[model samples]
Target: MSAPSRIVPLLAEGVLAVEGTAAPSLSAGAAQPLPAPGRYLVEPLPEAPLTVTLDERSVTIRPGGWSGELGPSRGGRVTGRARDDLDPGRDVTVLALATGGVVARATARAADGGRFTLDLPATVARAPYRTRLTIGIAGSDHVLGRVDAGRPPRAWGPAPEAPRLRIKISTPNLREAPLWGDSHFAASLAAAFERLGRPVGVDCMDAWYGRTAPEDAVLVIRGRQPVQLDPGKINLMWLISHPDRVEDAEYAQYDRVFVASDIYAAHLKDRGLPHVEVLHQATDAVLFGGVAPPETRRSAPVFVGNSRREYRTMVKWCVEQGVPLDLYGGGWDGVLPPGYLRAPSVANRDLPALYAAHGLLLNDHWDSMRDNGFLSNRLFDGSATGTPILTDPVAGLEAVFGDTIATASEPEAFAEIIRSCLDDPTPFLARAARAREIVLGAHTFDHRAATLAAAVDRIAAG
Candidate 1:
């Protein structure tokens, strides 16, 4: 297997259907073909973002030719040059999803997005692309493949139509940076919307330009960055994080506004942004739905998230209290003792199993988001998996989760929380079961989807 490599935005005219003839190759058609040292595809599309896969190797494309590591895109295999186009029989018309089976359209668009992510074209696409590329796998691990016989052309155009809503994700693709959460979050919600009989599709930020239909209501999962809004269609913004970056003018642009915090929604409403409503983050209960039997009495506290440069609250507390912690994420290099730092990230599809494997999960929040009263999605994810969780106290958490969640008021409280869980664990286990029931009932992505879907329906009707 080949190791991963990096590249950045290429101001490309179009996509080139290239394969890994050898290892992985990245060149500018100018950098002298990288001297053939490493195994890469090295071909230059020159004017567009290049995406390739090297066997089991992951690829990260960023700003430079290959350095920044902004995040990850889907890894692909150039295995035997995409087999010839074969329009298979429509025998597999039924899509088996978490919400049960649905007669999926013969067209190349997935109906139940929360379970089955995307449906690729049965034929090769040239341009005017509604075409979903490389990102072929679903959250449920199902894939939609096409029998493409045509080559990617160098032209582009736009289109519009049908009553539908599209989820705008921050991650460029599904198999993205291990810590990046938006794509999976969006996919979970998209499936829920489909279960309610609303047609939904997911798109990365870059795909918004030429592909978004004019009639489709756009749900922007506001996160670390901004995606441009098309005023012609019904525009909606759900401020999930980075509350400070969203200006008043931006809120004024959306027909509907959703903030993930109760206090933030109140603040917006008081500021006369009456469109704002409280829509907290959610989980896919069907996926992260069960508690697995313990492999060992492994009791080390588990925390999964990026370091974000500073020593996180939970890790800091555990360290000071002399408790062992199992950490997963990047940027914890100089701050941890040996054997404490686990893998930098777990894959999105693998998260359910990861959470299920743990005895206890610990979580914290960023100062900015925490101050804004925004709770992390892990709260929902860990709880949905029926894993006992200990987290830092925040406003509105108790109200949403009730005593189903165990929270600490300060660093000093971590000792008590940890000691109690290890000693008795019965109370915590009860809480976890209660939290799972509550989340599956009201806080799953389906619940949130129903809330937002009502608003979108009303706005679209007008």
Candidate 2:
């Protein structure tokens, strides 16, 4: 019988063709019969080759060699074009991998025609690194592509050796969308460690709830309500907003306790956890930097917080007082009055801009825990965005934001504060801008990481 026809396209450079029926068995010496199942193995190819196998019938090979270099260098350019068929809206994340695992990841938005270019960090070590791209599409799973980084060794000398600080976050997940208030804190902390060049591990304490032991630093961000601690480990508890007051005996197990506000720190001190420190919550500015437009200055007034009973009450009071408030966040649905504008939970990247979009931002503490000294994430977020904040008069609020935040003790006072913000906005705006400059300059993730690393170094030295 005649051999099945050779159904795959055999093209010279730049030629294109649709595939046909199955290719015939190779005569003794055809280019080692393009691997079985028609999958092209182009490692030997000078450039990565693109081969398409047609419906089990044939294969078409397009030989525009792939240049595997990933990302740009300090003085060099990292450039590449993605096929138009790739998802456009999704971010194309390029990960640089070393023998140890992913050393860095850079994300780029696909151009109108699906092209992408990224500026890679120059500090990466000179080693055999691989690059992989992942595209996360809405309503679908992420798609990935792999390429061999084709660049030569960087001329920079060997990377400096730094002490490795490993931080483990006991939480549900580390995604940008947090299920609870503490989840947001945990995610931010983990991201901070990563930014500081520390290897961070996030494990669901709910999965390993009671299993606790002395670790490098096992940070528990609101895992339990009463602030349970493990006597065996150097446990650090990060009380996101507030927690039920624990007995003195129970609070002694924590080596370090971090509270978002001085009120909470005072609560911890009152409860006998004297080692507590007031580390104001911070926005992931790297993420928020993506949200607000660079050219747009603060415009609308806004409020961000949980849409719980207390929050809804505040929203209603604002509406009753005829205040126009732009609301952005989840859970405040039925609670916000009819006239309020609701923005979906702002993306981390968009938060800075979101804060920047509003002239004034409001922060309200839970009425039940008002005396407990809790400052919500909104305080930090608003302050970070240089948006003046109008909040409940709390002990630490004034200290942290100073003149940037105006506080009111009652609903009527709150409304008046909002009016004042509207009537004479310059002073508040200037204060907010100064506050933002302070936090961005000194309280950023990098700063926090440096602090944590120094603490870890001290511990190690001892």
Candidate 3:
């Protein structure tokens, strides 16, 4: 018999929950957080159950169970020109594979002119690290074509005479959109390089399988692990989430390694990682300007981040203290107590307005980020938006953000910070204004861009 189906709230922690029932145990980082309202995960029931709606975005079980989240926006897009001989009326399917695993699959009818586009789930974008594309008929298994579609956009703008420098950035894909919030370092850094009078190309780790940078390009790799690239002038911007685990041998291939924080750079330098430098995360002024209107401004404390031990501690403390905290990000649903308001993930572009609307923004870094004194990009983003923040204390935070951003070392201290921020707005607003000036003056993406250009120029000169 086919298994029965039940509606469950899907959480980032991988717990499956039915109404009025406890969630099953979830594994670390493998599970997604509890989805907010209007979202559901479909699970099989013990007994056979009739499914009434088996649509792509939702599934409904008879005897009253329904589950599913909204489908991906327009599916994963696959755009390629069709062959002149191919039938425009027939449907086509595009499949993305990584290490022989079906990562993303989508189907769409050919447009009138033989140009085809298919949208698959966004999860398909992250995968076996190498991108191999296969096109086949929608229903039949017959494969029609295969190609390694892993090229970064060849053109940034009109080509310059003897392109000054071609930098290919390799970073984890933050999100599908190229916005500052969901940036794959390549995209934002590309814009920065363009402003500095150099053309650049950007590629994410997922789509760069078996890919080699053009002979004339410099590969700027920024991620935890090493991405395979040919031997060249590689500048490794290592954002360490786990400093203790980083092996010097893994990074030996790169010529220079850039850490996001001074403390981290010092740590790696002491450990004998060659050519270590500091390149802190910063905010983009255009994206994070404190310009939200007065009517939409908020006064409550807002926390936006995914789960970690620190997050669990802070969120629980806030709940027990009866602090009216607003939570956003994934992996909290299964773990967090119900009735505490939870919001879906916010886009990077929307975060400035969101921060501007609130009186206080809460931040806590990853263990490595905190231990090694690496700053969270959210810090600069909040500061640039002129939003007051109460974050856990880090070694070098005060030196960079100064008194503009408050620090709370303990859970009790975090609670008190929330209470005080809400109890009176006067001092907090003043601090936020000061923080905005500091960010605008020395901590914007423009500043980072200049730093990046100078670093590259120095390397080229040497």
Residue-pair clashes per candidate: 16, 12, 15
Q: Which regions of candidate 1 are displaced past 4 Å?
A: 1-162, 173-179, 212-215, 291-297
Tens-place lDDT digits, model 3, residues 1-462: 543332332221111223322232221222122222222222222123222222122322222121111112222455554321334465544444333234455554345443455554444443333244444332222233433333233223333332344443333343643432324344555676677676666655444444455533355444433344434333444453455544454455565677778887887788777787787777777777646635544657888876743446567778877777778877776677776556758766677888878878888777777888988888888888877888888778887878889987777778788888877877987998898888889876677767766665555555
- The Cα error of candidate 2 at residue 390, in Å, is 0.9
| lDDT at position 413, candidate 3 | 78
For model 2, how many clashes? 12
- After superposition, the stretches of candidate 3 with alpha carbons farther than 4 Å from their true spots are 1-185, 209-215, 219-221, 238-240, 293-296, 308-311
- What is the model-wide C-alpha lDDT for candidate 3? 0.56
The sequence of per-residue lDDT tens digits that candidate 2 reaches over residues 1-462 is 644323323321111222223433221212322211321222332232234333345343434322122223333234444331333455544433322234344445554333455443444332244232221211111122222333443232222433343233334344523545555555666788887777665555333333344244456555333322323334565565445533343344556667766776776677665777776666666654334434544444677665754556557677878777788766766666565757756555456666777667777776534666666677766677677887776666667656767777677887877777778777887887787876677666566656655654543343
lDDT of each: 0.60, 0.51, 0.56
Superposing every Cα of model 1 onto the true structure, what RMSD results?
Answer: 17.8
Taking all chains together, the TM-score of candidate 2 against the true structure is: 0.55
Better of 1 and 2 by TM-score: 1
| Local lDDT at 102 for model 3 | 44
The RMSD of every model to the true structure, in order and in angstroms, is 17.8, 21.7, 16.9
